[model samples]
Target: MRAPLLCALLLLAGLQACVQAFYLPGVAPQDFKRKDVIYLKVNKLSSIKNQLPYEYYSLPYCRPEKIVQSAENLGEVLRGDRIENSLYQIQMRVDEQCKVLCRIDALSGAQTKAFKAKIEDDYRVNMILDNLPVAMVKMRKDEKSNSLVKLYERGFPVGFTATTSGGQPEVKFFLHNHLRFTILYHKDEITDLARIVGFEVEPFSVKHTYETPWDKVSPTLNTCNPGRATFVTHDMPPQPVKEGEEVIFTYDVRFVASDIRWASRWDTYLLMIDDQIHWFSIINSVMIVLFLTGMVAMIIVRTLHRDITKYNQLESGEDAQEETGWKLVHGDVFRPPANASLLATFVGTGVQLFGMAMVTMLFALLGFLSPANRGGLMTAMLMMFVFMGLFAGYFSARLYKSFRGEEWKKTTMRTALLFPGVCFGIFFCLNILIWGQKSSGAVPFGTLFALCFLWFGISVPLVFIGSYFGYKKPAPEDPVRTNKIPRQIPDQPWYMNPVFSCLVGGVLPFGAVFIELFFILTSMWLHQFYYLFGFLTLVFIILLVTCAEITIVLCYFQLCSEDYHWWWRAYFTSGSSALYLFAYSAFYFYSKLDITKTVPMLMYFGYMSMISIGFFCLTGTMGFYACYIFVRQIYGAVKID
Candidate 1:
């Protein structure tokens, strides 16, 4: 007894350690040392340069190697009449009109004063000051500044570069004057350069011009900086451009950089600890766990009770006349789900895929596969697919046995391949598009093969195992006999149709999220920052509830109308989330974005469309299974002829 107790305590300790290690970051002590923080300086644009096409504008890709070659000769790259880089460290890509837009960054306290002084002194700079945060600027001596400035400003993202080659010791800050046409001097060498250029300088703390949401870990961002042209608007302005025709407007900005003090990774951790918890992960986990527990508990308890009660009655030889829930539908229990052949295949695959999804999500939430894990999610999802395939095989075989469906091989093959195949095909096409763009963020070829391997290796064998057991179970007997002649489905009016009801059921949930959808799309497509996982999870739960309730309510109404063909309709009714998701994404583009045309927009929504479909299937499956159980219970318990 003593030994056993000791062993149990040891095991518990190990588990606790594991949990703590995963949940917490930066518990160990580390030396505090500052690192290099890169800054950008965008030049100002002249009036004539503001209205130029993207094709006519050009920005040189600056690197240390190039910097050495063009040292002290920065004007070689700043030759264009336009303001190329309004935001720091970002390079702009051209649009159809050869113009670039700008994003604003928060200036350090010291930089703020200098910028204000420049604004007061220069009237020409004030004319193109749309992107500047008027609210922040208004709080100072410039009381006459407009308080309402739109967040988005039109300008170019001029190119700038800085490096800490020998680490912090060799570090220097880059600063630019209002015109950005001439070299003002480096902050570190300011005293030396001040003597040469004759301007007194003061030192200040250097911070990012704009806060990048994921900058803590993902600092090496070259692809998503401001001033880059949008992929979709490569061919905007349908007419052929004249040599000097204007397309997109641009603006000028001036920046100077200085450094006072720095924080290390350890410093950042301490700062976060001093502040409040991140809260996003914790909140999402708690709610998800609660909902899952409730759902699972309800299914387990009700199902076990009903099964035991039926078995006892059958054995007792009581005139099975009590005809209570689910048992009343003996005849229909094995009736093919509406669109049985199609739905059976689709859902079978979905069930398998679902199992995989659950495992992957659990692992991610548990920190086995975190954002830090990189491609771990893809790897895990692929492996789960194979295991889920096995479940699909088993479920298909069991349902076929219940139906006394002949040609077992056909059923098994269709069940095993159909749903997974469709999902794969859709995902594959999108992946191809991602590849064409040479996106490093896209799924890799090796991962795709791994997915295939997992399906064949894990899922196939498991499916066979499941099928063997499914075939062994005795077939369920029908309580009611089928009529020799099939009953004809009535011709309902347009509004009564399944398609119409599905569309209606989706409206409310879609409305609830359309506004939020803009932020999400901006993050993904426009490469904007978003880390609101907690709020997203809350909305997700609401979405799930909304989808399930609305679908069920519509299903109930249809059943009242005597429409028994709910199999596929029930699924699609809730499944309309896919349509709504795509539609809202489209709305975000047209209403919320300043996109030019089809290609990038199509690419953007296309990937999102696939994700929406996958989620649609997941939500729709939940609704279908829930309604199926409810219908089977209420109707199956009734003593119908």
Candidate 2:
């Protein structure tokens, strides 16, 4: 017994050490000594205008002897991150001046053309050191305050066009080949241990003229001080990428001690945005929308109460039956809607997505999901969506049964396949487009298979189990019996027409959220970090309230008009907001972005379509549930014999 106990204790210690060694999905900080070699990893060449990312090697540039790729997670791959080793070198706590990286001889015509096109398209080079993205130090003046505004441009330009001093019409293109790095490290006074707290770089286009012979390893440059070899800042003429041109690449490194702590290192980088996000405007706009919705909702509830009272008091009297507006259609109101199966499928999927969003946002708001953990948000969303299948299946089954629908198998299949199928179809097409361009943004076939496995293996099974239990439960009886024959709905006024009413109903919900949508879109296409989960959660709640109230009000109007076909209209009334969302996206594309290519244009619209569809589902579900509850309460309150 003593011998076994010793062996078990030894095994447990080994396991604990192994777990600490691999603390998973997140990385810990490293302590650097005086001469530690720090590797530079090249990320994608990005542009806010084009809204598409290309691999670092897409443009012809200096290459290391043997390029090696770093392993990445699912979210990183989806986000188009391709971190790989580069030719540039660095040493921690050791300053170097004008160190030669590489010398590229005879730039090809294709390479030159590519460089020029990228410059015209406003591409920027992005490099990573110690997980910190390089940024350019730029200065701007505030228009309103009339003060100098300091800014850190996230990435430096790949190249720029410069006009000739002779005032010629032709402009020359210059490539940024030289970089100056300023690394900030925080050292513990007691132990003298240092941790990298910040990384910044200033890129310049310099044509170097060397007095010494060209050497692959060491080339003494006339541009450098040579004495100190640590304070080189040559303001030489820029080099243009041309056919058969000798382009030299060099970089300088300097280290500075900082007061920042390792834990709070990301605070400065995360809050590096130049312009304020304008939260006050967004909140005020949403409040106006809410105020309008509240008034309409109050009117609806009071009018409904008065109508119900009149109907209930005169059940024995013949004259007062026609007096109550909605009571006349009580018989036909409970009728199962057309395409009830489809409606159930859509609502079920919407419930899943809503659950996913709520959980993810709450986690983010609680600070459990930090931006420092790359890919954490995407991974969380995907995982939540998958697991939320249980709610979708249960709700779909219950709803279909409420509609008195048979063919359970058909409904189940539709619930499982419909929404996810459409989303995957769009995503796969976008991936194909990315693959055609030979970009790293494309999801690999293996990753696609893994996605399939998650869908089929995990989510599908959970959904099936929930559906089985849901179908077994008895469907709740309707408040009023559905008539055998439907009532002839009166001709509605022009304002109450289906299309006009849906369009009007959607406007309020769109008004409530469009302000927040702008920032979300900016974060998506412009590659800006958006972690204001508290505000996002609040906006979503407001959107839900808006959708529900507008839907209930419009549904009440339909019942008052003696038109009982409220099922599809209630869904579409809230869903029409998605049309406005897509339209807003189009306006944003034209007004805010400068994407000139057809492929990127298609990509922008395609992704926006997916976003719109998800929004439609979310808002529509809210409306449907609100209408369902309202109809039940109003009808159940009166004696409908």
Candidate 3:
């Protein structure tokens, strides 16, 4: 047990050292001279509704002569990111307007249907140039500015549906065929090196009127000609997407110099958005912590001290026997509850998850796991969880031994397999559903195999080794021996019932972090950036404190009620917060999102279920340990034989 803990500490230390000494840049910026070709990359077509991403070239859109896929990490693959070269060309520090790339005289029936379906689903085209994701600029009313202000939505929508004005409105599909790009760059004062900082595009649709006849090689357009160019305007009519209809692709790229530093260039693109809600969340959480702290302090300082003092003054064992409440049930208080195996496994898994979350947040806070690292954060989390298996097995084995369990092998296996197996099963089923939809969001078979290998190969071995040593290690000291026959818990009132108490106990912990949970979900599903790891870390610590304090309070009361079956109750009391988490997820789905598809809805619930389950383990473990310590100290200080 101590070995695994030492190894984990060492691993964490090394990781931190590596991050500080030799930090690897996720996407390094390159300085380009005048007229240098800057390659543009397209990521994928995404929609908030479906939540299923498709490869950008999946549709009959214009593509580069050679589509070269960019290298991706495990996280990127899991995220359904398919970054590839694009057809649109750009030159550093050069302006281009109304340059036509290709002309499609007629769209195939299949092409037309695909475009219409994508438009209906509200898909957005995500593009990347010089590491900055291109955003669609929209004008919105700003209260401070009496006029309209430009707002940057992360990705540009594919197209919109339109109805022509007539006696009977004719429904039609319009495509945004023209893009006006605004590339912001920063020039070094010393070296004159120019690095691209921001990329924003205004999408427009222009139904071109051609002046020169349709020639395979060259064509002149009255609406858009390179020599006498008519730049794309917002008021221009969108090109209709119908069978046997002509479509022209055009783009304009203009580069502007700025004084912003390369390091902070992402600040503008991160929000373009209020954080008073964040302040309120922090304050609310701090207040809850303080309240719980005060209650716990009162119990320790005023209540527990008096009880111990009075109990210590008892003349003999006969006087102690007359004592009521917790002192009467001291012998049974530390007895293991029903299904000790399950508790041990879940507690171990929870510790593993807790370690991963703490370290990941630390990395994010230190700026190592920036968005520029693409899939770095996810990859780090998965790796950390896998490596933390050592500690999981150690703790669970010790718990199993403490429960007087003999099947060390079986208990260790359960600790290694239970939580991850269930999570992986849910993920695999969801991946199959994604495959059925032909969505790129599905994890590849190779990646699935790798996940299995990590679980069975590396993680399983570490868990077994840790468990073997943990079983060899001595169990913790028990102040009093458990009676061979269990103590019968007295009939309790409705509010003191196990279920009711657990439910009530979970509320404060959930309340401490729901506001932050909302923001996390928004960032995950709504395609927004979340960089406030500091606030997240604070909330995380507060949540742990809340769970621990609340459980200790409830356990003290239960002991006072003379109910000795607190082992499972402590776990459930904190774990029930996952219930409210699922409830809030349902509420958020209906209220915050525009997802109308069946698969996406299923996905939302499925993913939320996994998160809730994980959270149950994390918080439950905190609570169990807290109660364990409280029981140990109180029982140890009392006169028990």
Model number with the top lDDT: 3
| Cα lDDT tens digits for candidate 3, 246-288 | 8888888888888877887787666543466888999999999
Over 72-105, each residue of candidate 1 has an lDDT whose tens digit, in order, gives 1111121211222223221211111211233223
Which residue runs does candidate 1 get wrong by more than 4 Å? 1-334, 337-339, 364-371, 375-386, 426-447, 459-481, 490-494, 508-519, 528-540, 594-599
Can you write out model 2's per-residue Cα lDDT over 302-413, one digit (the tens) per residue?
7767776777674546676446478899899989999999999888888988988997787788775666656667767777777777778889899999998887668877
Candidates ranked by TM-score: 3, 2, 1
- Runs in model 3 deviating more than 4 A are 1-26, 138-151, 164-170, 215-218, 316-318
lDDT-best of 1 and 2: 2
Off by over 4 Å in 2: 1-26, 140-149, 165-168, 228-234, 272-278, 314-316
Best candidate per TM-score, number?
3
Model 1, position 552: C-alpha lDDT score:
58
Q: Looking at model 3, which ten-residue stretch has the lowest summed lDDT?
A: 17-26
Please identify which of the two predictions, 1 or 2, would achieve the higher TM-score against the true structure. 2
Q: CA lDDT of each candidate?
A: 0.44, 0.80, 0.85
